[model samples]
Target: MIERPITDWLPLTMKEVEKRGWDEVDIVLVSGDAYVDHPAFGTAVIGRIMESEGFRVAIVAQPNWKDDLRDFKKFGKPKYFFGVTAGCMDSMVNHYTANKRLRSNDSYTPGGEAGFRPDYATTVYSKILKELYPDVPVLLGGIEASLRRVTHYDYWQDKLMPSILVDAGADMLVYGMGEQPLREILKLARQGVPFSSMRNINQVAFMHDARTPLADYNDWSTVELASHETCLKDKIKYAANFKIVEVESNKWQANRITQQVGNQVLVINPPFKTMEEAEIDKSFDLPYTRLPHPKYKKRGPIPAYDMIKFSVNMHRGCFGGCSFCTISAHQGKFIASRSEKSVLKEVDEITKHPEFKGYISDLGGPSANMYKMKGKDESICARCQSPSCIHPVICSNLDTSHKPLTELYRKVDANPAIKKAFVGSGVRYDLLVDDFNKNNNDGNHDEYMEQLVTRHVSGRLKVAPEHTADDTLRIMRKPSFKYFKLFKKKYDQIQEKHNLKQPLIPYFISSHPGCEEQDMANLAAETKDLGFQLEQVQDFTPTPMTVAEVIYYSGVHPYTLKPVKTAKTRDEKQAQNRYFFWYKPEYKDWIRNRLNKLNRPDLVERLLGSKTGNSGKTTSSGNYSGRKKR
Candidate 1:
């Protein structure tokens, strides 16, 4: 059970149940993939909220998320209901996994195909629910169903149709943080409330009005279908790349395929300014119950449970507005945080792990180093989910930095059993470098950086430089080279004083929006000079809901408000990647010869890309954010 603070206002239902003296209400929240005992978004937070409201909630994460008719027997029709998400919780995983088809739905499954896609999973969940529960209302909440709640575009069948409601067989969907919506639903349900009566709940995404026929699940341009077919099972893959085309006029469908099924078709709603409504203290006042996670799954490609994954969230949300990231899409614009004491408690528990050799802890969130909570008067810019902020560069509103985090690191280090603490999550270099000289209210300054080096890492710290070119990064919403230079300089000095030979790990991406040949030339040149082993070069895969993915689809960065080009072929990507290897002695001469043959002599260093993710960057959090959403 969660050990939350006493004064914080708990969910209304939680309070009501406690007041009413009820033991438990039977309820089940279903998903499409393996269950993570912890809450990434809905699992824990929503589950906790449910318990707070005095209802019993069980997360059946990662069920056979499909629209097929047969897969619904696991949790026989619950007396309460089912909650649905995509393949891997949300579009975020789909982004990281590169839109490849998952292995579960082999060629033999009725609606199965290779390459990771959440649709197949949702389809399975829907079909099973329809066949089994018949009348029990199924609610879809996660990214897959939420983002596709309208008839805007479909990547799979290459043509738009109605909402996932019809496709997945769920009666309705509640988007964003299900806290508010679920709380409302539960309160209403306990009082004998129906779905129609609970329509006014906040953060809920239901079929809008009754006039039109929302498109079908398989509706979209061929480009969308092609990529969705190839992406791995993750939430972002389904969300990243979609062009928002407004209805030509306000023409409803000629014939409503599923008349009542038509909710309003959603294009893109401004991220629900989750800030004004978010009760941070209440949100964070979770039970200090560091209990074992029975829902934890085994790791893939090796031993499943490697000392049970424990996570420490340093920050949340992205102002970077990268087209390919969905943290901005899912978590909303606000950056919420826990107090240092809270973080320390979590770390202390982690140190108690039986397998604690102290290799690494997942000290990450959307952007690990971005624990900077902004000031109260963000009056200059009210929240808008239009995919960007109107800032000149990085917003100054971020008063919360990682200084306390560093101190917590030091305290954790004080434990003799914990030999090291790695930042396994994304190091928002931009955030860390932001007031580098000015030691802030968080107690210490560069000490965090030093700890990042001397303690967490074995030798290198992974930093996502994303792309070397300014234009590309501008589109990607990542920091500029000047920032990297400063980070590298700080990193180098720290390395020298500590007599640490570890190189600063920096990752680069190829074929992002707005990348020109000269950009590739510049990247190659940068890579060759960086002098570190560049292990991996990545090709761009557009996931759903990310600004970058929009750039991939529209050929423009949503924030930059500019036109861009996506690389058209594998050969083009190969050509760009070739530059990264020119510095390796083993392949240098040969690669150099090829570069010379192409008449591009200066573009070697820029070509470097590292699979190890900037082996020089320091972090103890093993859960790294790939291609950090600006």
Candidate 2:
């Protein structure tokens, strides 16, 4: 391999573009995030990938859309096309909270500033580029476009919107991680193929006339979903469409999906196969500066960059497939892990950084322990249509071993330049429990748990139980709280054995679909009995392309079409959310009153102390036996 300059970050400005003595760029990328030349940021990865392919790529980060349109015209137009993304996260998630309130700061922005990027950033930027450069093709990618590729639900607007490709008036949209499809698209463009004629690429979505012929489109069985007009008039059809969308997304062999938005047809080409190990390893091995762009020096640090600057990602995609999560929808359920050699090389690169702090903040991916994890039988997995591999019960064919991840952890910690390496990503505790891994012979569940508790944890290990009630957990596609209890017991025993005082932080969600006020109260009482103050909790937010969101909006579960009770009104949501803060003095009276009205005075006594002050009387079922104080 030849050596390249360590500081070879892609150009971010016209002056930097001129420094390379290039009069024109082949590709100009636009992003909603501040320019950070790190792999963690999607725009940087795309820019670096294009550069490595011998294309002159320049980036326009967080361009001022409300200004005189100077930012859009800064690069004039690229020879190939303009790539747009809403940064690493979806734009709405970046700008607002679950309660629909605007956030005070954006972690992706320098100095944690807010308002740098507009809402619906991909659509906004794409529209602006089309307005300025009418002839230039606008290509949309990233989480925003990927999730909103077809007619889907929009939480902020509380409506079923058409595909973003239609709304933005862009030529095409690239869904999922763009490396594979993007390379093919650029290659076709170089061969003199026009953008309008480039609809055959996999993982790409585009609009076509409803009456277009399909016979000439090659070998692909097309599945037409309910039209956008029908979905707008009836949400049940919309919910039904998502079921098909999710199933096709995870299958090894899937049919091309099409939907009609009025007279125009929105066609989503089936995604390419999951990136092989070598392919994903190559992506992580790109020449990233591993630092923020120099232009952001005066703007203070980008919070998102600073958090993961010293960290490393070992894999991509998640198979857990929680109902509220979009990871499976975008990245797919297939886990694509990087080679150990590739990961260790990146760690060595981090050690050489000038700002090395003798610490690696994280060494994990979407789910920490899911590295190299997949189905034991490839044939079964290829035909499997289940959204979650571990849900309902861990699949017998799935490989739930933690040995690879445990060995990788030891290798990273052995580096002399590193003092400690922590696992910051949320771990799926169910995978670590013996009950869940009983089917696998060499799972080494005990060893992995011991190693994680003894080494990787930084004072506390975080896990997402999501909810305590079995009904809610089932709806969330998460394991029951019984597994949580078993995991906690083992965790406590491990802590005691090591003489360590690390706390197990469990995350929970309030006001989720199928969760009643009683469920929240039960959660509070159960967690309180376990001696948890319950600091980390959230009210469920309804995002697009998620089962929970479908249930929230349609009032019917997508899988069974059964009516799912959801807290829609502010008062109902607030009432359930208050139970999460039962320890607070102000909420105590409110919780007590709410429980009392439901004829559950026992919960009030359990959550709130009685006059006798013995923390109330405990029943055989672990709940308080006494009634509320008069």
Candidate 3:
């Protein structure tokens, strides 16, 4: 392996820019994350994509927003536009926990430090750029901007805020993956098209004066959502607006959406079709140092980078569309997979790293088993408006085969430089249960399970069943918990057949919409019966752009317009979460008292066991950990 020079990285400072012999840069990206030149990092990917297109790109990462305003002035202004992102994860989610407690550290920062970025970093950074530059266009991207592009709920603020464009005062916004729309934007900019005239581009959102006629570039039919003012006064109208936004977001051919907010109208164009094989491969095949910038050598490791330094993401986009998830909302429901060659090439690159440890951390995407899986029929998928392909029931048009993924894992393992490649991402367990998916008519399901358990099991295999109660599961867009039982039965058989001892860890959530105290008690009792003491649990926090979040704010399901009960108060949330730790001594008496008050002493006995000091502890079960997918 060759050592990379400092010049191998995208210029992060003026000194590095001077080394490149560039008097000025074309595009300057301001990010809330430290500059890690890896494809997994959004700032790095956007910078490299611009550089590939013959643009001089410079990055100002984790710029000081509170001090002298020097960081904003350092790069001055770019020739094209300034791109801003809140880093890999949303800043609020990074800075706060589910209980709204200020987190002590940020995984994306050097030394896992907090305070490197501000709350609503995108809005902060963009506002700063507009105030400082005043003349240059400010373009927004990344998950923070993408998910907040509409009138959505903000749990931290406990209010419904208008599109981020209104607050940020930016010229344009790119939603979703940004790669496809970015390329088109670059082409138009090269042709000398003004930034304000980019309304025709797909996946781009911007504000237009309400008094003017809305421009129709592609002649796309438009759907108007209830105004932000209307959502504030009428919760039912707010819930109804979400249904239109979600359906169009997942459709193959979608209508342009607009919403009135104050004097300006927000225009969000339909997204481009999913990326093809060569297109997605191009994004991954760019020149990357695959390391954090050298300036961070003494600051300690970025926890997010360290976790994925040896991993390979085979694809992007998740079709699971869980109610609490933002994956489909931001990445779209369609899958954009790389060619097998691209994935294997990335694996080879990992093995050549100087810190190569003969182990690959993850060889998965948004969901581990969703590689190369999509709708079996193109026309059917085009006409489909459903957000989840495998929730409630698996779509007959969907292809749930796991053969390609199984074969890919074998190829990676066969590389003599690699000792093991584990799938660290959460696997969609329902896809493996034949009773639910019914698409695994061939032996692919069993064969994939055997391969995964025998080779990829890194002590335990984690799956997310979310919750146990059927009523709660329905609102979560999850299959019945019975399917999880069948999946577990099959998983255990595979383990026994292979003579392996890997524990199967399942995750659950409390305080989600449609869940009640009795439902939580049932969850505790049912899991206790399985000889497991649950450790993986979380109280649901409502984030923007999710169905559960809408329900939490509006008190009704967006799809059905029916009232759904949610645990919102601190006491209510705490009560539901306590059920997860029923085995802990501190919570043992509380569980007994709470269950007795609910008038179900049977639950107290089932969870805490007979009063003769039955500890309710599992002798040899693995501890479950909670998952909060951003």
TM-score, prediction 2: 0.96
Q: What value of lDDT does candidate 2 attain over all alpha carbons?
A: 0.86
lDDT of 2 by residue, 1-630 (tens): 113442376878788888788999898999999888888889988888888788999989999899678887888778989999988888998888788999999988989999999999999999999888899899999999999999888899998899999889999999988889988987898898998888788899999987876444658898889999999999899889989999998888888999988888899998888999999887888988788887787888888888898999999899988999988888899999999999999999999887888899888888888998988889998889999998888998888888898899999989998899999888989988887657557658788888899989987787888789999999999998988889989998998998988777777888999999899999988887877776546888888889999999999999988899999999999998888777676787687777889999888888887635644323321222111000
Determine the backbone clash count of candidate 3: 0
The number of clashing residue pairs in each candidate reads: 125, 0, 0
Candidate 3: where are CA atoms >4 Å away?
A: 1-3, 626-629
Q: What's the distance in Å from true for residue 15, model 2?
A: 0.7
Q: Name the lDDT value of residue 469 in candidate 2.
A: 96
> lDDT tens digits, residues 120-212, model 1?
456556667767778777777766765555442343333334556666766667755555566667888888777655544444545435464
> lDDT of all predictions, in order shown?
0.52, 0.86, 0.90
Question: What are the runs in model 1 whose C-alpha is more than 4 Å off?
Answer: 1-25, 40-45, 59-71, 87-119, 146-166, 212-308, 357-360, 381-392, 414-418, 434-445, 557-562, 583-599, 604-630
Clashing pairs in 2: none
